[model samples]
Target: MTFFYNLWYSNSLQYKLISLMLYPFSLLWIIIDKLKFLMTKPYTSHLKIICVGNINVGGTGKTPISIFIFKILKKMGHNPIFLTSGYKGKISKPCIANNDVILFGDEAIILKNIGPTVVSKNKLEGVKYIENLNSKRKIYDIIVMDDGLQNYSIGKDLCFLTVDRKSLFGNEFCLPSGPLRQSLNSCKKNINKIILTGNRNFKKNHNILKKDILNSYIKVDKVSVKKKYLAFSGLGNNVKFFDTLKSANYNIALTKEFEDHHNYKENEIADLIKLANENNLKLITTEKDIVKIPKKYHLKINCLKMKIEFDKQDLISLKSLLKNKLND
Candidate 1:
């Protein structure tokens, strides 16, 4: 993963050369992806499905945006639930309110705390399980998929492709050669809207973004931590978390990085605590990371809660789009 970490972000000649060598593998990857689409028709769900996903290989603030959209749907008096193909988790079948982070992954655990949540290895099966769960008691109006734009296992009612303004499309190549999961043209054909997950002016960065597609902006919420702290995260883009802290004027004493979807061990936690004590720095991490840790350590660790806010016109447009979907 670290090799990928370097290959995707570094501008060094060596990395570029390696990417070139791996270019053929990327082509194979895209073929396999496309073949799956050709062979299998996506499952159609009865409920409206709003998919907040990305074509980029790493994080582009999908979770925060999903939560933001969920809040809006709830305010509109609709029973919305989160459905995801839970990554890095062991699940024989779809799980509902599955509190075991080790079994369902950290993201699902976090979502369950916020509202009703379901996870499956297959998103189509996940939707099926939700329908069964609803029949027993509670009913949900819509399903908000956390991340599955690339997985065409289920038909999506609405799709929002999240993009990072900075590393828009690394090297503008696909897979092992770059950060894209699929080609930009293929992505354009699939996604309905683009949600840029940073405050950078799209007008200025438009040359890099290039597409004349409909898009909106959402700034990552940077809550001011009152004290100096050490930050750590297992996000696909950990630098963003550290940068957010720095931007919020929070003094970051030390920073720790882990592979995306990293599962913490006792020794690692002990070592981190030891370092924090030695430096007299408070422990801080993203809310996503905190959910993966033991509940016992919750009091000792602080989470940087992420909130997503869109521009006024964009917010209105987003809401109207959802309402229209419901009406349909």
Candidate 2:
């Protein structure tokens, strides 16, 4: 994708054809999406559901936002359930989210730390799991769904669509030509809230994000000064991740970059260990990456966590909306 992304951006002709082909489907998708929206009709959850989704295909920090929502819901004294499509995991039968990265992927694994989670491609199945649960042990008071924006099956009490600052709208085209899973226009009308992740000014002037959805950068409170560790992440952009560590005041000893969702091999792990030792650094990775790492190395793993600072007005409005959503 990285290699092709460059080629697609550079060649307008290539980009145009791809877009043209998708254009018909994109149009059809809009109609289908609208019909689905109108026909399916959003169902009210007995327990509240907040979904963190986005227009982009990936890398909008949806997972982080999902985790934050889970925490917020629990802090309010409501049990929360996380729902995901289980992108690459195996478990055909719907199941509760577990803390096994290998089994449920890193995102869902981190989510479980906050509350109960369920991974199922069948959205209704996940919802039904909760509806049919013991009325006594009603494990979840609410649900936080990760990446369920276009999914019409399970209705959300609230929806926050995430946007990557750097690649806000890849080539301004839809899938196969660009990174968007749906049109940017689709997000604005459907989403209850829009969250812009990364540096404060990530996608400053895209007409879509810049106008009103931007949120300030969540500043780093403290960081290790003298001795630092080598932090490597394979999320969206490696440079930005490195910059974030630096901004947080960590003097990174060494940084290694890799493709998104890369599977770390034994030899590669050994190389990282050697590099860290040679440079006198510890290994720090993102929660997403750490999950792929075998448990034998779990003790050696460290991940950085971030805070989301919503605007004062937005925050107040959101809190109120959520309270009502959860109550109703």
Candidate 3:
């Protein structure tokens, strides 16, 4: 899957041929996506809805950005509840998310730790659930949709599209042909703002205006530089995790990458432990990936905590913008 994902961004002749062959399917996908938006009437809730989403198919740091917004809202004295589709989770109906990775997936569990999070397959159902829950005591003042920009069934008060600076828009084509979930033009029209995440020095190349774009970077917690570590993760962008570790000056002995949201088997974990032990290195991974591992092994592995840090001016503007929107 990673190989194909890389191919999507490749500009080689083979990629061009493959993209051409898949272009028809991409067109069909776009047509169906647009039709869904046209057919469905979005549900509007009294509670303010802020969506953190992306045009790309893979992760664009949506979870972190959503968490950041949730924290901001919390500090501003508003209760914010997360609403997510629980992408790989088994349970389909709307319910409060829990730490069971098999039932709610990693992202849902992570969001649940920060505040109240509802996991639902149908986002509309999730919004309705939040609305009903708030009616009694008004506990949740806002609903933050983790990744639902393409979800046309719920009206959003403010929508933020997260874009990784490293991989802006793979091949600049829609799915099957490239990484984009929707056309860039459609994204600009739907999103209230674009949150660019990654290296702060990365230049802007998209069509969105500079004023509409907010810059942010992942800030990793300090790790012991003396110890050699074996880093691994099953994130949408594993390279980004590895890059973050390198930037933090961690002495990585070896690194391994897995498919996004991979279900780690006991043997896999055992193998990793053996390899790390053999190389005299500590096992380290992202916070999102650590939840799936058995609790017994938790003490053996180190989790790299990360947070999104926005530019100073951008942070001020975002806070003000959010306050104004909530007041409205």
Candidate 4:
């Protein structure tokens, strides 16, 4: 099911009924989570915890955004490390983010460039690893969590809720029935910041439920394309990928978008290369897609670098908030 279309059926009201019947599950889920928060000790000590998460389930570009903040922290001389429930890896302890995208997935590998990073499924275990770090050798002051908006075990001073600009509150249904991880109204109350990825919706009441914390709305555009290219990606919203190219006025000769978190095969790379050569087009893809691709085919590809374009005041507030967090 393509995340958004899973909620309702066209012919019958059956889907809606089923979803309504299961709505209690969302309430139950919310209650259980609140209880978890009430019971779990909020392991907080003035250390800055900035959560970059989303409203819908996939494709908000949290990893790149996290790296962007991490780089800024580095420039300002504050050590930053990335923490994640390390989606998909089986590593036990908070090992240095050393594995390649193929090994530990793209997000963890990407953060390694900025500073120390760890991917543990357990949040407490991951934080423990950070706590026991060598105090003498460049201790980390700020933690940029990639996907912890739902995690209450660790309290964050500021949480940036990232939503794929195209799919904000997909189908507006919670989990199994839709793309939303939780209720939309809950997000408005909990999040410290709302970051919109890609172009603005700009329609009447486009942001009906999210009017409150729309402080940071980031849009990604493609770099100027001086040449014709074959575009493809394994991202959640590949339409946004193609739209970015279109916005840049780049003519795409061919494009093949895969499922989210797709693992590339040697044959897949070869097929794309053959197609690109046949069409006389240069291959371009997103960074997340490039990581899953085999290294042998890397020389043949160039991943589109995503830059977050923000308004002036928003940028100032974000930097100020970050600065204060670091100083604290």
Candidate 5:
């Protein structure tokens, strides 16, 4: 996956030839993806389901935005629970967040900390699990799917397609050919609005369907550390996290990138600590990445906590849409 991701972005002649060779496979991927959508009848739930997903394979502010929605729903006096496939996690049955519960997925751990969370391989089964709990306890009023825009097995009442304006649809190709999980046109019909998670102002004149652009960015807390520090993360866009630090004038001594949702080992943690001490640098990483680290080593590292915020009017518009949909 990392090799293909790098090749998809490379401009060298060899990479282009490789991409061309993989183009046929990408077409096959698109056909199979489309057929899956055509063949599957989405499972509908009685509760309102809002999905925050992206066309790009990697992170584009989905976690933060989903958390934002979860908080908003809480404020609105409605209970909301997160339902996810528990990517890369061994969650065969529905499980909720608890200190004693072991969360196998990086994103799942983070989401669990925010509110009630359920992890299951099947989205429909996850929803049903939560609904069953509600029947016994009346614990939740809504369900939020963190990243299932491409998964058509679960019907959604609202959908927000997130995009990083700078890297939207890299090379305009799919899968091994490029970064897109699905073709741009195929995703447009499912997206109710586009959330641009960058500084570039999205203009209506931009070449795409006319849709509302939610101007926002991942709002990180200000760090007080003044010394040079080593920044590292296992994120889809590790560079983006580093770039965010650079934008904030952080004294980045060095940076390292790892595959998204990377599981950390004791040896790797020790290595990072050793490297940081050798360079007299503090080790820092993203909140999402930090959660996966063992607690005993947490004091050895720092994390940049972030949240997503939309403009006032834009947020109001979003809430209005949600309210209208739920009322239906």
Candidate 6:
């Protein structure tokens, strides 16, 4: 998958040839997706729905941005609940999220830690479940959808399309041809704003101007610069995690990458621990990956906590936007 992802994002002659060969399938995907968008009548919930999603097929900091928005709404005195599909979880019906990563994926558990989270395969069902739960007391004021930009079944009051500044729509082609889930033109039509996450000095290459974009960068907690560590992660963009560690000046002795949302086996974890012990290095991983590991192994591994920090002006703008939506 990583190899294919690299090829999709590549600009070489081989990438061009593969993309040309896959163009027909990509075109079919685009048409089917567009038809779904046009046919569905979105359900308008009484609660405001703020969707944090991405056009890129892989990670673009959507979960982090969603958590950021949830915190902001909490500070503003608005009760916000999270709505997610539970991605790789076992359950199919709508239910309150729990710490069981096996039953409800890592993201659900992460969101549940912040506030109430509803995990449902159907977006509309999730929204309705929230509505029913709030009918008596009106506990939740808004729904912070983790990833549903392409899901048109539930209408959103505010939509944030998160983009990694470092990898802005690689190849600009859809699906098998490129990293994008849909074309930029189609995505822009549904989103309220583009949340650009990455380096502060990154230059813009897309049509979205600075004014229309909300800039953010990952804020990692300070760690010991002298301590040698063996870092590993199973994320959509493992390179980003490695880059973050490098930027933070961590002395990473070794690194391991896995497929996105990989469920670690006991043997795999044991090997990592053995390797770390032999090298006299501490084990480190992203918060998301840490949640998936068994509790007993936590003592042997250290989780790198990360949060999204918006630019000063963008923070102000986000507050104002949320306030206006609440009033409306």
| Model 5: colliding residue pairs | none
Candidate 6, after superposition: displacement of residue 121 in Å? Answer: 0.9
Q: Mind sharing the TM-score for model 4? A: 0.84
Model 5 stretches with alpha carbons more than 4 Å out: 1-3, 10-14, 99-102, 199-209, 223-226
Residue-wise C-alpha lDDT for candidate 2, range 51-141, written one tens digit per residue: 8887765577788777766776667887777888666676687788776665676666767776677887787778777777747676667
lDDT of prediction 2:
0.71
Please provide, for model 1 over 171-239, each residue's C-alpha lDDT reduced to its tens digit, 9 standing for 90 to 100.
878887998988776778777778777544434244343443334454455555667798999998887
Pairs in clash, predicted candidate 6? none
What is candidate 5's local distance difference test score?
Answer: 0.81
- Candidate 3, residues 128-175, lDDT tens digits: the string is 998899777778889999998999988889999898887888787898
Writing each residue's lDDT as its tens digit, candidate 5 over 193-232 gives: 8877853233322436467877776566666557788999
lDDT for position 163 in model 3: 88
**Clash list (residue pairs), candidate 2:** 97-117
Give the whole-model CA lDDT for all candidates, comma-separated.
0.81, 0.71, 0.87, 0.71, 0.81, 0.87
Q: Candidate 6 clash total?
A: 0
Q: Write the per-residue lDDT of candidate 4 for residues 30-70, one digit (tens) a residue.
A: 67766776687777844577788876666776776787778
Clashing pairs in 1: none
What would the TM-score be for candidate 2 when compared with the true structure? Answer: 0.82
TM-score, one value per model: 0.91, 0.82, 0.95, 0.84, 0.92, 0.96
**What is the clash count for each candidate, in the order shown?**
0, 1, 0, 0, 0, 0
**Which residue ranges in model 3 land beyond 4 Å of their true spot?**
201-211
- Give one digit per residue, the lDDT tens place, for model 6 in 10-30: 778976898889878888879
**Which model, 2 or 3, shows the larger lDDT?**
3
